[model samples]
Each structure stands twice: as structure tokens, then as C-alpha cells.
Target: MRNLKRLSIGPIDLDVAGGEIIALTGPSGAGKSLLLRAIADLDPNEGQLSLSGEDRNAISAPAWRKQVMYVPAHTGWWADTVEPHFADLSRAHVKNTLQRLGLESTALNWQVANLSTGERQRLALARAMAHEPKILLLDEPTSGLDSENAARAEKLISEIAKSGTGIVFVTHDVAQAERLGTRRLYFYNGGLHEAAP
Candidate 1:
């Protein structure tokens, strides 16, 4: 991120190396999610963002977004069934991802209407990883999950990060930050205070 600024947060210049996880923690309105949104280019923000040294403006929005995926807390379910939401993925791939997230392979057959909030959260994460984004922006990915499911989510994401995808996530859970963050940034006084990785 270079000179990235948006919504009370800006001029954020940092390098998120491949295979690193940076956790953003702070009180409400401190712009933790806003900062993630800026880096992902989901919100209107000034400055530049580059991945592997490539400028963000050089690519189309859709293409750039494909590489830097942003997973919102509540993912949109435009289709009635889970399979349709992942129409781009083969059944095998979806099933593989389902199992990776601790769901049975047959979970692909479930209806979206029947999924609980936690299910949606996990499924949304699965969807995000399907494209293999170089940068993964997760907005409180495990807020809806119980401890077991949350741990499962963390493990899955950790695997992704280890595989060389940079991860930037927002979490209010300090323990979660300690567990998952390779580097932690505490948002305070409308600014960020950095901590060692």
C-alpha cells in the first residue's frame, strides 16, 4: 500500500509481503475495516496500491479485484443454492474447499436459505479463496462462528497465507490477533500504531 487514504484513514504506506498476515485491531470507528477497504480498493480512496510491485491503476478494476479479493463479513448470496454461487468452480473444487473448511463434501448440495450465519461466513471464505487471490482482505471473517469453527477458519486462512497469499484482516478479538497476525496494528486516535510481527 502506498499513500492509500480513505474515510478518515489515509496516507497509509506499508508493504505486506507474500505469506504475511497483518491483523487490524481497534475500537469502533477507528477505521480498521476502512483501512482494509482502502487497500482492497472497494471504497473510494486516494493513493496507490501495488501487488508484487505492480501498480493497481494499471489493471482493470475487476482484474485487480480478482487478485486482491475482499471478503466482507456478510457475503451476498445471489442464488438460491450454494452451487450456483460458485458456478465458476467445478464441483470437485467446491467440495474440496468445503471439506477444507470442516464442512462435509456434500455441503455443496445445501440450499443457501438453510445455512446459518456461521455457515454463510465460512462459505463466503471458501468462495474468496477459490480464485486464489494474491491479497486476501477478510473483514471479521469469524465473528459469526463458535470457538471450534473460528479455530477451523483460522487454520484454513493460515494455510492460505503460508501458501504465499498476503492476508489483511480486521478483528476485535485480541487473542485472535495474537494467534493469527504475523504483524499487528492497533488503530487508535484515528491512526495506526504498529506492533512487531
Candidate 2:
């Protein structure tokens, strides 16, 4: 992204290579989520955005979003059952993803309203990985989980990055950022800067 502008953020530039994970941290309302939303083209913004050399405008919005997915902090479920949210639960990779995230296969049959916040978060992450996006924008992905579950989610995210999927995740946990980020970025005074070593 070059000269990316959204709300009070940016006129910014950034590059996330495949297999790289960039962790973003800052105070609340610092526009970290906005930046991700803009990158995903979920909101109106001005910039020159592209992926693998193709301009974002070159493709339809839906196509662009599929390749650059934004998984918000709170996932929205349109269906009553969790099974309806996934395109195909039978795919081996999809099942594997769920298992790796410490989710049971039976959870898919449960009612969405009955699942806890942490369960929904893991399920949402699984849903995004199923699509196999080139880049993933995660907003506080492990916020609702305990230490054990958070570690599982972290492991899965690292594995995804190793497989050549670039990731930009926002987190309040400093230790989590240090563990997962190839580079740490700080959002301050409406600008993005390299975090102190």
C-alpha cells in the first residue's frame, strides 16, 4: 500500500511479504482496525493498493476481498447453526484446521447462539483459513481465549504464515506480538512506526 489514507490514519506505505507476520500494537482507537479494514477494502478509502503486482481496482470487490480477507474481532453469523457458515466441512484441510485450533468436530453442529465468545473466535479463524486467503487481517484474534487456547491459535497462525500467507494482526498482548511478529509496528499519533527493539 502507498499513500493509503483512511479517516485520521495514513498517507501510509507498507509491504508484507509472503511468510511474514506483522504485528500491530497501540492504544485503543488508534486506527489499527481501520487500517486493516481499508487494506481489505471493506471501507471507502483512498490509496494505491495491490497484491502480487495486481492492483486492487483491477478486480471486482468480492474477488479482492476473497484474496485479502479481513476477520474482525467480533464475527458475524448469518445462520443459526455453525455448519452453515463453512463452505465445506468435509474437506480434510478444513477439518485439520479446526482440530489444530483445538475445536471439536461436533462443535459445528451446535447452535451459534450457544457457543461461547472464545469458541466463536476459533470458528471464525477456521472459516477464514478455509478460504485460503493470500493475506489475512486479524483484529484481536485471540482476545477471548485462555492462555492454552491462545497458544494454539498462535501456533496455527504461525503455520499459516510459514505456508506463505502474509498476516497482519492487532493484539494488546505484548508477549504475543513478540512471539509471532517478524516485525512489530506501532500506531501512534495517527502514523505507523517501527516498534523499538
Candidate 3:
């Protein structure tokens, strides 16, 4: 993104190379989520964004969003059952993702209302990964998980990036940022600044 500005953030310029993870950290209301939303085109903002050198404005919003998937912290679900929220679970990759997240395949058959907060977060991530996006904008992806599940999530994220997905994730855990970020960015005073690795 070049000169990306949202609400009170930016004129920001950033480039996330393939297989890279950029970790965002800051105080609450620092516009961290706003930056991700802008990049995903979920919120109105001024910017020039491109994917693999293709102009963002050149493609339709839905198409741009498909390639650059955004999975919010609390992902919205419109269905009563978990299966409806995702693509065909028969796919090997989808099943693999669920297993990797420590979720049983049967979880897909359960009611959405019955899930725990951490389960919801993991399922949301699994659903997002099913699309096989080139870039992922994640907002506090593991905030709801316990230590074990959080470690599983971090490993999965690292594996995904290794497979060439550019990722931008928001997190409060400084250690997690260091563990996953190829580069770390700190949001402060209405601007994003680089942080030491």
C-alpha cells in the first residue's frame, strides 16, 4: 500500500513480500484494526493498493477481497450450523487445517451456538484458510486461545507463510510478534513505525 490513509492513520506505505509475516502491535484504539480493514477494503480509505503488482482498483472489490482475505477477531456467522460457514469440508486441505487447529472434524456438524470462544476463533481461521488466499489480514487471531492452542495457531501461521502467503496480523503479545513477524510494526500517535525484531 502507498500513502494509505484511514480516519487518523497513515499516509502509510508498506510492502509485504510473499512468505512474510508482519506483526502489528500497539495500545487499544491505535487504529491497528483500521489499517487491516483498509487493506482489505472493508472500510473506506484513500490508498493505492496492489496485489503482486496488480492495481487494487483495477479489480472488483469482491475479487480483490478474495485474493486478500480478512479474518476479523470475531468472525460473523450467518448460519445455525458450522458447516454452512465454510466450503466443502471433504477437501483434504480443509480437513488438514481443522486437524492442525486441534479441532475434531465432527465440530463441523455441531451448532455454532455451542462453540467456545477459542473454538470459534480456530474455526474462523480454518474457514479463511479454506479459500487459499494469497494474503491474509488477521485481527488478534489467537487471542481467545489457551497456551496450547495458541502455540498450535502460531505453528500453523508460520507454516502458511512458508507456503507463500503474505500475512499481516494484530497481536498484543510481544513474544508472539517476535516469534512470527518477519518484520514488526508498532502503531503509535496515529502512525505506524517499524520496531526492532
Candidate 4:
């Protein structure tokens, strides 16, 4: 990013390489989500965001968004059944993904109405990965899960990051950030600064 500034959050000039996770931590209402939204191009902002030499401005928003996927804290389910949501991607593609996130393979056969909040969260993560985005803008991806499921999510996400996809995640838990982020940044007062390991 070259002078990436979002709703008074930053002129954050960031360079994230593939296989790296950059964690953003901050107090509540400190524009952490705003920054992620700006990076995802979901909101209006100023910046030069590029990926693998492709300029964000040069590409269409929909196309750019396809490559840089954003998964929000509150996920939306539009289908009546779980399998329909993943029909194009196929259940087999995400079979291991569902299990990796502590969901059963039979979860593919479950109905959308039957899924709990935690199941929705895990399913959203799987959906995002199915697209195989070049970058992931994850906002509290495991906020709805229990401790056991959260650990599974963290581990699965770490493995996905290792596959050369850049990830920027926001979390209120400092410990969670430390565990997931290869580098960490503090967000406050509309500024971003490096955090100590």
C-alpha cells in the first residue's frame, strides 16, 4: 500500500509479502474494521493498494475484490441449505476444510437453518478459502467459536497462510494476534505503528 488512508485511520504504507500475516490490534471503535474495509475497497478511502504488481486502481473493483476477499465478523447466509451455498465450489473441495475447522464432513449435508452461530463462522471461513483469494481481509473470523473451535480455526488459518497468500486480520485479543501474525501493528488515534514481539 502507498499512503493507504481509510476514514481517518491511516496513510498506512504497508508491504505484505505472500505467506505473511499482518495482525491489526486496537481498542474498540478505533477504526480497525474501517481500515480493513478500506483495504477491501468496501468503503470510500484513499490509497494505492497493489498485489503481486497489479495495481488496485488499475483493475475493476469487483475483479480486485475477487482476488482480495474480505470476510466480516458477521457472516450472511443467503441459501436455505448449506450445500447450495457451496454448490459451484462443490462439497468435496471443502470436505477437508470443514473437518479442518472442526466441522464434520456431514456438515455438507446440513441445512442452513440448522447451523449454529459457530457453524456459520466456520463455514464462512471455508467459503472464503474456496475462492482461493490472493489476499484475505479477515475480521474476527473466529469470534463466534468456542475455545476448542477457535484453536482449530487458528491452526487451519495458519496453514492456509503458509500457502503464499497474504492475510490481514483484525482481532481484539492481543494473544490471538501474536499467535497468528508474523508481524503486528497497533491501531489508535487514526495511526498505525509496529508492535513489539
Candidate 5:
């Protein structure tokens, strides 16, 4: 894929591609999330971002969102139970995703208020993946989980990437990036620099 011309986000410049897992890593306040937001068109900035050769400005916001799903670091659950949130999805698929993420089926019925941080993170991921968007933008997806659960989440992400979904994962964890990313984009000094393979 060809890298687009550098796009400006605040004071940063970034050029990236879709269809591959591009990990954004750097110290805090390096604008990793800002870069993702710019691509999502959630922020007003002077830059050009295109997906599958379609210019970002040419598409409706809702249309862009349908193809590009962004999962934030902290997810909010507005419903009392998870089942209702996933009601539109197939029960079997929901159950399988929960199981694969190391969550119990019973958690689907549990009150959202009662879930732990890790549980909520997994649920958010499941919710995002239920729609099977072509591109996924994730921010610190495994930060809330323990080592084992984190590994499970990573494996699930890997599997999703292998299935041909483009992923842009933002994380500070070097090992997670190394494992999940086909390419690495280091965000520093308000710009993205490609990392050595």
C-alpha cells in the first residue's frame, strides 16, 4: 500500500495505510490517540486521509464510521445488561466471542455496574467486533487485563487481522505491538516515523 502525504494533527504529521495492523507506540502525550482521531475524522485538522482510495472528506461520517470502528481505551456501558447491547448480533456469535475473550456466558446477564475493568474491556471489544467492520482502530485494548487475559485478547486480535481486517492499534506495550502489528509506526514529536522490521 502507498503511504499518503503527511497529514497534520495539531502540530504532528502522519502518513499511514490501511489493510495492515499498524501499531502506534510512544510516550504519553505523544499524540497517538490524536493521530487515530484525525484518521477517523473526529477532529478538525489540515490533512488528507483516505481509505481504500476513497477520500475521507468525500464520505459521510456515518458511512466512515461503519467501515472504520474505533475502540477507546476506556469504554462505557450504558445498558443494564450486556445482552441488550449485543441484542442485534447473533446469540451464538456473541457467546463465542465472550468465550474466546475468556468471559463467561453469565456475564452477559450481569449488570454493567458489577463488571470489573478487565471484563468491561473485553465486552467493549466483543461489541466492536460484532459488527465486523473492515477497519478497527484500537487504543490500549489490553491495558486493563492481567497477563493471561491480555494474551488471550492479543491472540484474538491476531486472528482478526489474519482474517483480513485492517487494524490500527495504539499501545505503549512494545511486546504487544511486536506480536500484533505487521508494521510499527512510532508517533513522536507530532509525527509518525516507520520502525525497522
Candidate 6:
């Protein structure tokens, strides 16, 4: 596949493939998140964005969203206990994800209000993984964690990518990108620049 033409926002372009992790990095206001939104059809834009040879616009929003999920920087929690939020989740999968993220199984019963930011982040990651989306849109998912927790989170991401999920990860942390991404894309001036090897 070829990179689409530069969007109106600026002069960058990107060509992405399936089962590949593409890290997006740039300064703030550089439109990294905006680019993800545009690709996910959560924002207005003029250009071609396709998945598996089908144009993004041709698919219904909900269907596209289910297949290509976007997890924002600040994940939302609307319940008291974490278990309630994941009540529909498969017990085995939930337990495994939490364990992989370094969370004890007991954390499932903890109140959302009582959990720290890192815990919340891990919970969000777990929630997203439970859905088994084909494409993952992550926005600074490891931003609020301690080094140890961040490393665990990174490992989880690596494992997920290895399972064939296409990940478009947006982060300011270059090292994290280098560790997790198989390919890299830089967002700037409201567009995308493909990183060189």
C-alpha cells in the first residue's frame, strides 16, 4: 500500500500495514491525536483512510470503531468497583490481562475511586484488550505509570502486537515507541511523516 497524499493540515503522509505497530511521536499540538481521530473517523477530514482495502468512510462508524478501537489518554470509569465495569468480561481473560499488567487478581474488587492513575491506565488497557479489536489506537497509554508499571504495560503491548493486532500508538516517550513499535510515524503540522529505518 502507498501513503496517501498530504492532508490539508500540513505536508506529512503515511502508509501503514496490518499486524504492524506504528509509533507516532511529535511535540504537543503537532496533531498526533488528531491524526488518530481522523483515521478512526471521529473527526472531520478530507483524505483516504482504508482498512483491509475498504475505505474508512464506506463502513459504519460503530462497526469501524469496534474493529478499530481508540483508547484515549484519559480512560473513563463510570462505576464504583472495577469488577462491575468488567462484569461482562471473561473471567480467565480479565485475570490474565491484569496479571500481565502486574495487577493482583484482588484488584478486580477495588473501588475505581481508590485506584491510582497507573492502576486506572492498566485497567483501561485490560478493558481494551478484552474486546479483541483488530486495530488499536493508543494515546499515551503509559504516561502516568511508574517505571516498573510502565515496563509491564510495554510488555503487554508487545505481546498484543505479536498476536497480530495493528497498533497506532501515540506517545511523547520515544524510548517506549522504540521498544514497542515495529514501524514509526511522526505527526507534525497536522500531518504524518513516515520514519526512516
Give lDDT: candidate 5, residue 166: 86
The global Cα lDDT (0 to 1) of model 5 is 0.79
* RMSD (Å) per prediction: 1.9, 1.3, 1.5, 1.8, 3.1, 2.8
lDDT of each: 0.86, 0.92, 0.91, 0.86, 0.79, 0.80
> Which candidate's lDDT is highest?
2
**Candidate 1 residue-wise lDDT, 108-185, digit = tens:** 689999999999999999988888899999999999999999989999899999999999899999999999999998
Candidate 6 residue lDDT tens string, 110-173: 9988988889988898888877788889999999999999889888888888888888899898
Candidate 5 has its poorest 10 consecutive residues by lDDT at 1-10
Error of 1 at 57 (Å): 0.8
Model 4, 7-48: lDDT tens digits are 677778888888999998888899988888888899999979
Backbone clashes in model 2, listed as residue pairs: none
The candidate that wins on TM-score is: 2
Misplaced by over 4 Å in model 1 are none
Q: Could you tally the backbone clashes for each prediction?
A: 1, 0, 0, 1, 1, 0
TM-score of 1: 0.94
Q: Which residue pairs in candidate 1 have backbone atoms (N, alpha carbon, C) closer than 3 angstroms, thus clashing?
A: 5-10
After superposition, the stretches of candidate 3 with alpha carbons farther than 4 Å from their true spots are 88-90
Tens digit of per-residue lDDT, candidate 5, span 38-101: 6666666565566778887798998888778888899877788878889888888888989999
Question: Hey, what RMSD does candidate 2 come out at?
Answer: 1.3
